[model samples]
Each structure stands twice: as C-alpha cells, then as structure tokens.
Target: MSSIQSPKKGTHSVGVARQYSGTAGRIENCQVGVFAAYASRWGQALIDRQLYLPKSWAGDPARRDSAQVPDEVAFATKPAMACEMIARLLDEGTPCAFVLADAVYGSDHSFRRMLEARGQAYVLAVRSNHTLRFLEDWSLVQTDPGTMIADLPAETWTPLSAGEGAKGPRLYHWARLPLKYQAGQGFSLWFLARRSLRDPGAIAYYFAYAPSDATLEDLAAAAGLRWAIEECFLRAKDDLGLDHCEARSWHGWHRHMSLVMAAAAFLARIGADQRRAAYGKQNETSPKRPAA
Candidate 1:
C-alpha cells in the first residue's frame, strides 16, 4: 500500500486528507491506496488497487454525494482494502507463492487470519514490540520480538542478503524461531528477525506462516520481496504519473489508477521479454569449450 500526494489545495478531492505517506516520508494531505502487485522471478507489476475512504469522508453524505461516491461504498481500513484486492486476485486464479507486506497490514490479526484461512504462505513484517504466542515446554509462552531476540544464541544469527538494492545486495543478520503454532494440520509459524549489519540496534521483525519444511532462506527471501511493491509504486508515480490525478470524485481517482496500472503492466511485459531475448542472445554467442 502507498499514498499519493495530491497537489490539490483543499479537502474537496476524494480521499485526500492529512495522512502518513511513505512516499513523502511524513504526514501530508494525500490520498492513500492499497495496492496489489504481482511479483515473480520474471517481473513485477501493479495488478489491482483500492482508494481508501476515510471515516470522515464516508460519513459525510454531502462530500460523498459531491464526490459521486457510490452508496454502497463505505469506509474500509487499509488492511481490509488490501485483503479485498489480494482475495480478488486469488479468486481470479492468479498463481501465488507467498504473500509479503509491511507492518501495517501484518499487524492486523484479521488480515493474517484471512491469509492463513486460504492456506497461503506469507512473510509479513511486524513491529519490534509485536507480541506472539509460542508453545514451549508444553506451555504457551507470550513474548515480544525484543525479548525473543535477546534470548537467541549468538550463533543462531545468519548473515544473508534480502535482495539486491541500488548499492548492491542488501545484507543483514537474520534469525528465526519456530512459534510451535500451526495454522492447520501441516502448517507452521515462525518469528523472523533481521538485524542491520552496521547498526545492530536497527532491526525488523516478521511473522511467517508456511509449510513446516520452509527454511530460513525462504522466509528471508519472501520478506525481501516486499520491495517489489515499493518499486511498482515508484515506477507508477515517476514514469506513469500515478499521483498526478486531479480527480475530485471516487470513480475518477480509481479510473486514473487503473490507467496507470495498465501502463505499468505493459512496460513490465516489454522488460521481461527484452530480458529473455538478451539471455538467449548471450547463450547463443558464447564461446563453447570442447568437452573434456
């Protein structure tokens, strides 16, 4: 999910309010949209989205009518919007390996339960102070991330790269602890943590649910995939003017986003094709050594 900063001066524009925008790195008057991006080794692109309607906007009949918001539309939290979009894609038979999201969506219990109910694996970020229930010694143990990390053996932390960034591989010390909780008969739960190599105090936490055989590497890689959505937001806004919508109506905002998503999807397809072609060319032109 991301927020689009509006240049409009008033609150008349649909979904525009003083909210925290990760794009601006601060609270600003903007429209927030929960987006779903399809990501894989092949490529990534924005596939679906929902314009968030604040309670104020939803309750204000004057504003709703003025903005032409449909009567059926009501205020839904960002996490709810995210679930709706994700569920829609899954219901449409989209292939998914694992879901990845930031703390906002991850912190929501209903959101987590929805994913678990579908038997989908996910690595969702949580706050450092987020608590979890772990079964230890036949007793339920309640602990937060900080306490759990402090109790882990130093040797348990493994250095790994989440994914490639602008500088290079994003490396960190990662560790995981099995929560001993099962979502279903064969499911497993875990608490995963990543500590900055340079600043140990800087850490991130995640709750992972997957098959029991899922490895530390699998959870770490899935956690890193969250960046793909961020990249989608950047490309959409910078190249496709996703935030340039001047629409003051609900339908208008959605229409603009739909257009931007389509353009982004087209570009992703072109890039994927180019990459495959380049790889084929490289393979064909390579000098073949005689079989020894």
Candidate 2:
C-alpha cells in the first residue's frame, strides 16, 4: 500500500472538456472539466468541472410585470478556457506524459502546441481533412540547397482499422513523413489520414510528432492509448450520471459534477483492490483449510 503525502506540492495538470447539446429547453452554459495530475502512476486527478452562465440567463428588470425569471444563464467557451487551465496546472511544476484526449480537444492546433511548448508528450487525435507536409530525408535530393520538410512527398502510409467487424470500415490511414516543419522542430512528425466512417468519400489529415528518436510504431501505440480516456468518459456518464444530473444553476451543476468525479475515483480504487486480491488468491497453490 502506498502512503499518501500532502498532495505532493508540485505542478502537474490535465485538462478536460465536454460538449453539450445546444437545444431548446437546455440551459445555455459552458460545461468544461479540468483536472490535475501528480507525479504518480495515475496521471490525472479530477480538480473541477464547471458551468459558466450566459448573459441571456440574466433576468430583465423590465419584466417585473411578468413572472420572475432568474438572470445570468450559464455559458462557457470550452477550448480557450481549457487551454488556460491546463497551462496553469503545468506551470505548477508537473512533468508531462501521455495526454489522452478525444477528437474535440485533439483537433485544435493551438491546444496541441500549448502542450508541446511545455515539453510534454501527448497522443491526440485529428480529423481527416487537416493538412500537413510529409517528412522525408531530402539530403539525397539537394546538394547545398536548404530543403523545407513540409514540401516533401509522402513515401509510405498505413491504415488504422477502428470499426465494428473485420470489414466494417477504415478509421484512418497514417504515414511517417520525414519532412521538417517549424512547429515540430526537435521532434519527428507523421501525417495522419482519416476518412468518414459512414461516407467513405470524405477524408481528413493531421500531423503527429514525437522526439526525433521516436519510431512510427511507438507513436501509433501512444495515440491508441487515447481510447482509455474515452472509457473513462463512458464510466463517468453511464455509471456516475455526469450528464443526467438535475442541477439547473451553474454553481449547482459544477458542485454536483465534482462530487460525482470524487465518487467515481473512490469506486475505481475499491474495484482495483478487489481485483488484485482475487488474482492473488487464484495464483496461490495452497489448498483451502477446513473450518473448525
């Protein structure tokens, strides 16, 4: 068992974001989740999930003749705030490793660059249409001319399968491009190609990077781990009622979500302990003793 120290006074941060349906009768609020990661095996710890009220929610004083409607509706711009919060957490001194995120966060170049500037490693997803130059060893092509990496041609590509059955659909095709881009200096870059799951005609592209010594296989595996974050979201929503809560006000909603995250963490710990105990018992070869 590991002893808990006073929150290990260090800077480590993880940022989370959720998209809510902007429909009629739904509260106009910005729903975003942010967390911190300490230098432990578990990389992310739930810090807060907040809802910002919109200006429309503020009640009109002239409407005193009508029913009293509450003023200040919850509204938030998730992407920008999420970046700010993540930067704040990293500024606190936490080492970065393996940032797992869904496509919403992954599609943002600014967000990814923010992590990169902090010298953090990440595995983020990108939509199929994003464009990037292929990286290739152009030394053989040019004598003394300085060759730009982004203008190089793609030499190879690989398909990533992520659908139902063996023949369901192709999720994306990715290739390692050996070109140099200013944004990815000191790191290697790969081009990711994704097609629409439903309509096979649509396609997208993105660039992924890692330290120069990193291999293509390693980058793919790291990106694959992003699925774990999806599982976490499923557990939170399905088991912990992240989206079904009845809280209407911004403050109430934030407070409830925070509690739910805490409960989920506790339950996960309990489940881990039980699984470990069961595994240990099964591995033991000793015969069961008879009761006296």
Candidate 3:
C-alpha cells in the first residue's frame, strides 16, 4: 500500500493529467491497494508485481541507497508495470486464453495493442462515454454505437448467470454488436454490453476480441472471470495480510508482496481442494436413474 501527496495530484491516487501527487495528500490517505496479482484459475503461484516509487523517495539517492534500492530502480507507470507483469507471466508459461481489465488498463490503446501483438484475445471494460468505430466509417453511421446495441431486438439479449454469487447466481441481460474492425486470424471484434434486468439505464460496456467461434456465452464467461480476482483480493487482504506490508523501498515492497501472494496462494489451493472433494461426495450420494 502507498500514499499520494497532492490533492489535485491523484484522482483516487492515479494522477489526473499523468502527474504524481505531492506529499500532503499521500500522507493523509496513506494506505492504498498494494498492486498485486493473484493466479488466474490455472495460473501458477508466482508473485508478479512492480512497486511504485514516489519521486520523493526515488529522487533521493540517499534514501534509495539506504533501502538497498538498486541503481536500476526507476519510476514506471502503472499500465507499463501491468504490461510488464503480463509479459513475464506469459514467458513463464501462464495459460492466457483472454485478457480482462477495468478501464485503467483497457483505456490505454498502446497496452491493448501490446496484447494484440502477442496474439491474445481480450474483453476489456470501458466507461459508457468511451467511443469506438461501429462502422468502417463511424461518422456515416446513423445511430450511436451504444444505441445500435440497445435497439437490437429484445430476443437478442440473453439472460444468463455470470457466476455463482453469494445469493446464488449473478444474472444479467447481455447483448453484442459486430464492429467493422477486421482483426487477426481466428479473431473478431465486437461491442459487448450488459444491463441489469431491474434497471435499464444501468449498463456496462466492453470491447471484445475473441475467436470467430466464440459465442455470447463464451464472452460473458471470460468477462466474469474478473470476479474471481476480486474474491482473491478480498481473501488476501482480509485473511492473509496482503495489505499489511510496511515496506518503503523498492526491494522491500517486492519482498513483502511476494510473500503475501505466496500465502494467499496456499489458502486458495486448500479452498479449491475442499470444494472439489465436496463436489465429488455430493455426486456419489445422488440417486442414479435406470436406462430408458
């Protein structure tokens, strides 16, 4: 966890105009979400992270040297760090079928291109106002891309459960619209949206690239995988001390985060095994039907 100093500096601690906060606000809002990665369902127990070294800390060679921060310790943007982590995970043989993230990473065109260059498909969320080319000539399109999707026949919107939530299944209405972008082989681009059945105006938008064979169900499933990451964050922080790090230096941050991730992975493995065993037992006790 880290702090931001400037009030006009950080928008929730991510700079507004690509700048860092000053000391005052950082000291006030002190603790922040320690940037860390939890395993995707099949990901390994590797700890991949990059620490954000504030200019106040990074600029001073004396503090850097004291904390054993190496000479190569330089400031890096969050998106750059996320990309670096993803690249390293890929190099380490992590199985990545698709990429998913909120607007922070999704809004970066360069980062999206980087993933495409690696031949990976993605379903990234963006704010409602985020613009895209619905047609080859977007200017010529009569209706807004969002309106185009919204105006689709009611039958086109599928009601589905994204996953098992605390109350049972998390259900929503989803629709998609084909965009004019001709992507790489075996892939196609589309605009995906999800709206709550209870509130029509409440909608979330996503830009997706997936195999030509991918269905709305498939895209929805990929989009829902982020919830698992959220669960892991809660588990790591609440049960495993993920946010309790006292590290101030570059190396110290890495060491602290790595250890926390390791412990979190351990807890995750145990929980997964328990669920599997219970599932197997339930199957064994269920009644079998005679052949028709």
Best candidate (score: lDDT): 1
How far out, in Å, is residue 261 in model 2?
0.3
TM-score of each: 0.92, 0.57, 0.78
lDDT of 2 by residue, 1-292 (tens): 0000111111111111122433223322233344332222232234444343223332334332132223432233444455766777678765555554544566677878887786666656655444444335753333211122233354554556533234764355444554455645666555544445465445443346667787666566555444444455557667888656554344455667788778877766776667666663634577776879
Model 3, range 103-196, lDDT digits (tens) per residue? Answer: 6676667767778778888888776766654444445544444666667888888997776678987889988887777588888888888889
Residue-level lDDT tens digits of model 1 in 1-292 = 3334554458899877888877678887877887888888778998888888888899999999999999999988888888888888889999998988889988899999999999988898898888777677889888888888988898999998898888999999999987755577678989899999999889899989999898898888888888898889889888999888988989999999999999999999999888777764536568886789
Candidate 2 error regions (>4 Å) = 1-48, 52-76, 93-95, 131-155, 158-174, 183-185, 194-206, 273-292
Candidates sorted by lDDT, best first: 1, 3, 2
Arranged by TM-score with the best first, the candidates are: 1, 3, 2
Q: In candidate 3, list every pair of residues with a backbone clash.
A: 4-26, 5-22, 5-25, 5-26, 6-22
The worst-scoring run of ten residues by lDDT in candidate 1 lies at 1-10
Residue 207 lDDT in candidate 3: 79
User: In order, what lDDT does every prediction score?
Assistant: 0.85, 0.48, 0.65
Q: In each prediction, how many residue pairs overlap at the backbone (N, C-alpha, C within less than 3 A)?
A: 0, 30, 5
Per-residue error at 183 for model 2, in Å?
A: 4.4
lDDT of 3 at 287: 79
